[model samples]
Target: MVDTVNDDTELFTIGELARRTGLSVRTIRFWSDSGLVAPADRSTGGYRLYDTGAVARLELVRTLRELGLDLAMVRRVLARQATVRDVAAAHLRALDAEIRMLQVRRAVLRWVVRSGSTTEELRLMNKLARMSAEERQRVIDAFVSEVFEGVDPHAPGAHLAEAMSALPTELPADPGPEQVEAWVELAELVGDEGFRQRTREMAVAGARGGEQQPQGPDPERIAEHAGGAVRDGVAPESAAGGEILGRLIGPELSAEERVELADRLATFTDRRVERYWHLLGVLHGRPPMPPRVPAFEWLIAALRAHARDASAS
Candidate 1:
């Protein structure tokens, strides 16, 4: 029943307000006690009574609460100390960060399942995969910095070191399984002391050779001729391999020259180093390039073969 405070005004008791607003009497009493939905008057028996404006305020408070706002935020909204739009914008940024973290966790779980990772592997993968973009970049930066620490910055390969350290500005907020796997593998690769030493060797060599134009066989020619021989399964030490090597670096190269060229090639051609570039390609959303290390390995072996044959003769 409505309490007629005047001819024009109708007031509702707690029970009546609950019936009208579809809220519980206990909830209405709590909000009233909390000063969010204050009573407009007191009945003769000392019960809480609300006017129509209170009913509207109660509905607004319920809507805000249902939207995940705490009582304090709702109070601010009700008091006009903060606008709903401003609160919503702040809440959205928080929700986005939370969602991104969950997505990364999901991706890590997927990787764990697919790889059958051990406890230790899973722990490491999770730690690497969940790092922020800056943290991920720092891992690469540290690796590159160590590898090129004493190497000359003006070296031809110094640019390559910079390229090696490149990471996307940020990882995709919702990364796929492959991306997670790439990041984990990359982190491990950079941390390997053996790989770091190999890279440093290449950097130092390139710095030493930077003063003169490289007189080595053309890379394009090597990839074409040597790459073909590798695909065709031609034995590196066989006669046919000699013909390909002639077309590659020219038969005029002395035995010592062949050995020197082979050593230089071997220093830079590493499967793990190539794998590093391949993994970086994956992270950068590039299509996979065919492995070039095998072709180069064949070239190195063939050079050693002919050099050894000449020495024996």
Candidate 2:
């Protein structure tokens, strides 16, 4: 039923209300018909007449509509079915999600432009950007599971399995193009059978519990010695290289331990595995660590040379 107006309240026709509120007559009539802004009374001529309070209501409706509220939600607000505060909160959440999606899309498109991506690549990146957090996590989880399945979790270097598998529960809400690219490349790397086998070799060697297990090396000494050797072009087989190795690992070591250490390092040293951690660090905003594989490779070669020389003597 239409609301009645008291004699104390002044009424305005639809045309008059439109002029006062700076809204069009057709819009006021449409809103009136939609029950969002109803007439307070009707004249004998049956023209819609609204009281002073209708002006305020019409302004509220116009403001709400301009702010992207559909007629249905506006009607609910007018009918007291939901409060403006509650509706605003819900809309805020929706807007936040939309904003995040737009940010990701912007980043992805920028990457596409910068990279001159092919059509298939564009399609793949778009699909990745649209995936939910859980979906992204599942991709990593499945890769980790396949690589480490049936392995003894408590074995040596087994702890690395978990660390290697650790992916953020979600990408950052507004991930950069490089981060997205990291994820895509990481996904592809993890799916490669050769890469999987390499990782498995390391895991199995670690699980063997002998001298074949992976070990941590001091980064500072390696940078000083092995890294310096590479910089100075000191060949791994040279006498100078042997002296550098002695300083790094100590001159007192027996040939057998040297040989065992060399074998153990060979089993675990993989450029791709190091790359996986490096990519993850980039994603998580960590300071970039210098590549250690080359240094270690040199060390392995030097150790093998010393073992050979010892055997010859």
Candidate 3:
């Protein structure tokens, strides 16, 4: 019950306010001392007293604190220095960033468990996973810049440099295990000196090919016929393999041309390079494409085999 301070005023002791607001007396006392809910008056025995308005103020303070507002922010809100909506909006953005960070850490842990990563590998994975989107893009950009340095952009396959450097502007706020794994592998792949040299070779060859029209054989035909031959398990030296090669590049080419085609194909093909694209696809949420390098390898072998037979004759 509230005690009457005068005919026109009524105030409650700290215990009475706690009972009314369902808050602890200690909490109320703390806020009162902090000047957030100032006492309206004092009692004869030197006890703190709060008018009815203090009870309402305590409820607002409780709500703000429960919503994760710090004491300074709570004070600001009570002081009308900021509106509740403005404070909430700012808090929401902070919460989003925190949530995204937690998601990335969770994904990294999940990948670590699946891969049984060593201490160094785990450390690397965590570092890469926690990088900001801009930092991640820089990783890819550096790789592309070094590999394609001085290579003509208009070259036949030089466009690949653009695609190679393409990483999503930001990883999904909640990336899955596959994406995390892909990112880690991609980071490692780009950092390899051997891979960089191989990619540069492809870029230089592409620029040379661009100097002439009709860049090598038709990739589609090779993928279809040569890919089919591989699927059918046809040996490259077999007569049956020659038939597929004919369908792939036509029977009009001479032994010299066949060897040239094989050399050209070999220059552009590497399983690790293909794996780079596969990882990119995983990160971009693209459907997994079947490996096409084996098929191309078969075509290269067939070209070499047939050319050799003709030279022997």
How does model 2 fare in lDDT? 0.81
Q: Which stretches of candidate 1 lie over 4 Å from their true place?
A: 1-61, 69-82, 97-120, 148-155, 169-174, 204-209, 212-215, 308-313
lDDT tens digits by residue: candidate 1, 1-313? 6787898888999999999999999999999899999887888888878999998999999988887789999999999999989988888887887788789899999877787878998888789877887898999999999999987787677787788988775667888889888998989999999999998888777777654324667887888889999989999999999889878876567789888878878888899999999999988989999888898999999999999665565
Residue-wise C-alpha lDDT for candidate 3, range 1-313, written one tens digit per residue = 5677788877999999999999999999999889899998787778888998998899999988987999999999999999999998988887887899899999998887787878998898899988888899999999999989998888677888898998887778789989988998999999999999999888777777654333456777778888898889999889999777777776667789788878877998899999999999998899999898998899889989999665665
Q: What are the candidates' C-alpha RMSDs?
A: 3.9, 4.3, 4.0
Candidate 3 stretches with Cα past 4 Å from truth are 1-15, 29-35, 38-51, 96-127, 130-135, 148-158, 169-176, 204-209, 212-214, 237-239, 251-256, 308-313
Ranking according to lDDT, highest score first? 3, 1, 2
Top TM-score prediction, candidate number: 1
Task: For each candidate, give its TM-score against the true structure.
Answer: 0.75, 0.73, 0.75
Better of 2 and 3 by lDDT: 3
Candidate 2 TM-score, C-alpha based: 0.73
Highest lDDT against the true fold, candidate: 3
> For candidate 2, lDDT tens digit of each residue in 35-100?
877787798788889988888998889877876789999999988998999988888887877887
lDDT of each: 0.86, 0.81, 0.87
lDDT (C-alpha) at residue 275 in model 1: 97
Residue 89 of model 3 has an lDDT of 91
